[model samples]
Structure formats: structure tokens, C-alpha cells
Target: MEINIASGLLAALGHESRLAIFRLLVEAGPDGINASGIGEKMGMAPATLSFHLSHLSRVGLIEGKREHRFIHYSANFAVMDELIAFLTRNCCQGIGCLPKSFACNTPEGTSSQHGETC
Candidate 1:
């Protein structure tokens, strides 16, 4: 992921309501939850939920699909994975500076000195 994309994703997650909304969607998995369900779960007004959902969707953190009269929202896991990888990339540098456990935490079977799971 590019810096701009990462920054945008972070910015979308920066807001409290948006963060809560995103977290809820992630927990809901690929099937996602509808706008009303999200509002009910978050205790947000319909308008407020719509606004936050739009912001999250704009940043590619979430995706909305029309299912009849309701718009279902789901977490975009691919973008999320990209952001995670980008942030943790080159974490401890290639060296013998980290412990075994730390290296084990890295994703893709790679090891990081600080135990950063990419």
C-alpha cells in the first residue's frame, strides 16, 4: 500500500464513531450488517450512522452493498491487510537483534526483531 492510501485508511479510523462502526463491521465478518443494525448496535442516530458509514466506505475501509431496501456494510479485509502490512513493513530491520518469539510473530512466515506481526 502507498503512503497516501495508508494515511487515508488511518484517517478514516481516527474518528471515534467511525472506529466503532468499523470494528462492528469487522466483527460481523464478510456478510456484514445493515445500516439500521449498525445504528442500533452503536446507539447512533440513523443520520449519524449513515455519515460515518459513508466516510468509512470512502476510505475503502468498508464496503456497502444494496440488499433490497437496506444497505449492508462489510469490512474490506484486503485493504485492512494491506494497511497492516504497510505499517509493519521493515519493522526491526534485517538483523540478529530480535528474540525468537518476536520473530515468530511476523506474518507470512517472516520474522521481525521486535515481534511485529505483519
Candidate 2:
């Protein structure tokens, strides 16, 4: 991701409400949850949730689709991965750097005993 885009995402996540909203969506996975479900789970007002969701969607961290009468929100895993990769890309850039394999590089469909796959 470009620095400006990364910065925008970081800034959007800097807020507590936004972070919470993002996490909730992340935990919900690609299938996602609806706005009202999110508000109920987080105990937030509809207007407040709408504001937070807009910021997250603007940053490409979350995606929303209108499903019948409701809008469902899901975390954008690809963007999230890009942000993570960018942040950790130069973790050990200089001499005696850790091997590239030391960095996280999990493949899809790799099952985790914890019932989560990253």
C-alpha cells in the first residue's frame, strides 16, 4: 500500500470506536454481519455505528453490501494483509537480519486447531 493510503487506514483505526467496529467485522469473517447486528453487539447507537462504518469502509478496511433490507459489513482481509505486510516488511532490514521465513507467511486453507485460519 502507498504511504498515504496506509496513513489513512492507520488514522481511521486510531479511534476506539472504529477499532472496535473493525475488530468486530474481522471476527465475523468474510460472510460479515449487518449494521444492526454490529450495533447490538457493540452497544452503539445506529448513527454512531454508521459513522464508524463509513470511516472503516473509506479506508478499505471494511466492505459493505446491501442484502435485501440490511447492509452487511465484512472485513477486507486482503487490505488487512497488505497493511500488515507493509508494516512488517522492514522489521529486520539491516545486516544479520532474521530469515524471511521468520516473518509471518501463512497460506490459505491452512487449518488452525483454534478454529481460525489467517
Candidate 3:
């Protein structure tokens, strides 16, 4: 992940609404969720949700596919994984720094529990 691309993704997630939307999509997994479902779950107005979704999509953090009249959104896991790899590439200066019991069992780009990439 180049700095510019990473910066763009980070900027898109910088907004509270966008972050929430991304997290929600991650939780929804590969199946994804439609725009209306996202708005309903997040208690956001359609316009507000649309704006955030557009930003996220533009940054390649999320993707949308048309299914009937609804557009289902899901996280772009490849980009997400690259971002995580970039961020942690220098962890502990290439030395094992975490505790011995600390196992990063989390999926490539997601949280430990349900696979939510940071």
C-alpha cells in the first residue's frame, strides 16, 4: 500500500459516520448489506449514509454491487489487509515485541472476534 493510497483510505475512515459504516459492512462479512439496511442500522438519513458510502467506495475501502433495486456493500478485504500489513510492517522494529501469550489470531484485516479490519 503506497502512502498516498493509505492516506486516502485513512481519510475516508476519518469521519465518524464513514468509520461506523465501514465497521458495519465488515461485520456483515462477504454477504454484505444494502444501503437501506445500513442506514437503518446506523440510524442515519439516506443522504448522510449515501455521502459516507460514496467516500468509502471512492477510497476502495468498500465495494458495492447492484442486487435488484438495492446496492449491497462489503469491505474490500484486499486493500484492508494491505493497510494492516503496511501499518504493522515495522512493529517492534522487526523483533518479537509482544508478549509470548499474545497471539494475533485475528483474520488478515479484521478484529479478533468477527474479523473487523482496523
Candidate 4:
């Protein structure tokens, strides 16, 4: 969760295509989706999908595992969790100014209760 690491993650996701790819992978969950499936689902060419996938993998946002001839990509949930915690670490300034219902949503769209810090 260092600044450089967080910055790299954010920068990698800054692009529209990469963001979409990441979102799709996040939605795919731990089992992930293969390269062909990702490209097909996103309507992206193989080369374009490869580029985005490489970038995401380089930044540690996504991980690729070889499953026979295909490579399955899944979001790195640990890194994602760290990034989320880092972003929301200072929320409410420790004074609880936000409502009690205020919570941070993980990549899976599930709400995580935040006591004082994320």
C-alpha cells in the first residue's frame, strides 16, 4: 500500500479499456475468465485484450494463470483490498462525521463496515 504501488495501480486503471477489463475480471471472481472469454465478452480484439491484460498484470491489479492453452485472469483481491483500505483510511477524519451506515464497497460490490478507519 505504499504510495508508489498505489499510484501504479491507479495509473494502470486510468485507461478506459483497462478499467473495463479490470471490472470484468473483478466480476468474474476468483475462478476468473480465460483470455478468449474476456475478449469475446468485451468485444475487444485479441491483440487489444492482450495489451490491456498485460498492463493490468504488470501492475499487480490482475493475475494470469495458465490453464492448458488459455490464460485465466483474476483480480488480485489482496492488492485490491489494500488499495481500498488505503484510499479510505482517512475517511471521516476519525471523528465519525459520516453516517453509521457509511461503508466501503469491495470489488465484489459487498459493503464492509468501517468502524473508524477503512
Candidate 5:
């Protein structure tokens, strides 16, 4: 990913509400969740949810598809993966700095028990 693209994506995710929305969409997987469902699950008002969702969509972090009366939102995994790859492109200067047991802790500080070797 180009720096400008990565920066834009990062800037979009920088907002608290947008980050939460994106995280929820990521958790929902490719099928995604509609605006109403996302609002309900996040205790967000419809307008607020819409704002965040739109911001994510504008930055290519999320994609919204019209499904009849509702719009289902899903994380744009291609862009996400690109962002991840960009961030870690030269990790550890090509050395295997990340151990197999590297921890990706959750918000609660518990280890995810998942790791990727460099």
C-alpha cells in the first residue's frame, strides 16, 4: 500500500467511534451486519452509526451494500490486509523478530494465543 493510502486508512480508523464500528464489522465477517443491527449492538443512535459507517466507507475501510431496505456493512478485507502488510513490510529488518508465540492481546488484556512468525 502507498503511504498516502495507508495514512488515509489509519486516519479513518483513528476516531474512536469509527474504530469500534470497524472492529464490529471485522468481527461480523464478510456477511456483515446491517446498520440497525450495528446500532443496536453498539448502543449507538442511528445517525451516529451512520456517520461512523460512512466515514469508514469513505476511507475504503468498509464496504456497504444495499440489501433491500437495509445496507449491510463489511470490512474491506483487501484494504485491511494491505494496510497490515504495509505496516509490517520491513518488520525486524527482515529478521524473524516475531516469535511463534507472539501475543495479540484482546482489549481486556488477555492473550489471543495466536501468533505469526516474521
Candidate 6:
């Protein structure tokens, strides 16, 4: 991903609520979760959740599909992959640096996981 694009994605995730919302969607998998589900899980106000969701969607970090009555939102895995690759493009100066492998996410799981040290 280009620097500008990566920066924009990062900026969108900079907010605490937005990050939480994004992670929830990521763990929700490709099918995603609706705004109400997200609000309930995150305990966020509807208007606040809507604002964060809009920011995430605007940044291409998440995509929403209209179900019968509500929109189901899912993480844009393609864009997420690009962002991760860009962030770690120079991983360990092209070699291993960290001494330990780090789990990518909490028990819910995420898009990427590194089993070995980079």
C-alpha cells in the first residue's frame, strides 16, 4: 500500500472506539455483524457507533452490506492485509529481530497470525 493510504488507514484506527468496532467486525468474519450487534457488544451509543462506523467505512477498512433491515459490517480483509504488509514491509531489517513469536489477537482471533519470530 502507498504511504498516504496506509497513513489514512492508521488514522482511522487511531480512535479507541473505532479500533474496537473494527476488531469486532474482524472477528465476526466475512459475514460481519450488524450495527445493533456491534453497539450492544461495545456498549456504545447508536449515534457514536454510527460515526465510528462511517469513519471506518470511509477509510476502506470496513465494508457494510445491507441485509433485509440492517447493514452487516465486515472488515475489508484485502485492505487489512495490505496495511499489515506495508507496516511490516521491512520486517526485522529483512531478517528476524524479535526473539519470540507474538499471537496476533485475543481469543476471538484476527485476520493474521505469526507463529514464528520475524
Which candidate achieves the best lDDT against the true structure?
6
Model 5 gets an lDDT of 0.85
lDDT of 4 by residue, 48-107 (tens): 999999999998999999989989999999999999899878878866444534543345
Q: Is candidate 2 or candidate 6 better by TM-score?
A: 6
Q: Evaluate model 6: give its TM-score.
A: 0.83
Quote the lDDT for 37 in model 2.
96
Clash counts for the predictions, in order = 0, 0, 4, 0, 0, 0
State the local distance difference test value for candidate 6.
Answer: 0.87
Tens digits of per-residue lDDT for model 5 on 1-118? 7899999999999988889889999999999999999999999998888888888998899999999999999999999999999988988897655544344334544344333322
**Model 1 — which ten-residue stretch has the worst lDDT?**
109-118
Question: Which residue pairs collide in model 6, if any?
Answer: none
Please, what are the lDDT tens digits per residue for candidate 6 over residues 11-107?
9999999998999988989999999999999999999999999999999999999989999999999999999999888887977543333433434
In model 4, which regions exceed 4 Å deviation?
A: 97-118
After superposition on all C-alphas, the RMSD of every candidate to the true structure, in Å, is 5.0, 6.2, 6.0, 4.6, 4.6, 4.3
Judge candidate 2 at residue 11 and give its lDDT.
Answer: 95
Per-candidate TM-scores read: 0.80, 0.79, 0.82, 0.81, 0.83, 0.83
The CA lDDT of each predicted structure is 0.86, 0.85, 0.85, 0.86, 0.85, 0.87
After TM-score superposition, what is the CA distance of residue 5 in candidate 5 from its true location, in Å?
1.0
Give the per-residue lDDT digits (tens) of candidate 2, residues 66-106.
99999999999999999998887776673344333433244
lDDT of 2 at 13: 92
Query: Where does candidate 5 have its weakest 10-residue lDDT segment?
Result: 109-118
Per-residue lDDT of model 1, residues 52-103, tens digit only = 8889988899999999999999999999999988977776784445556656
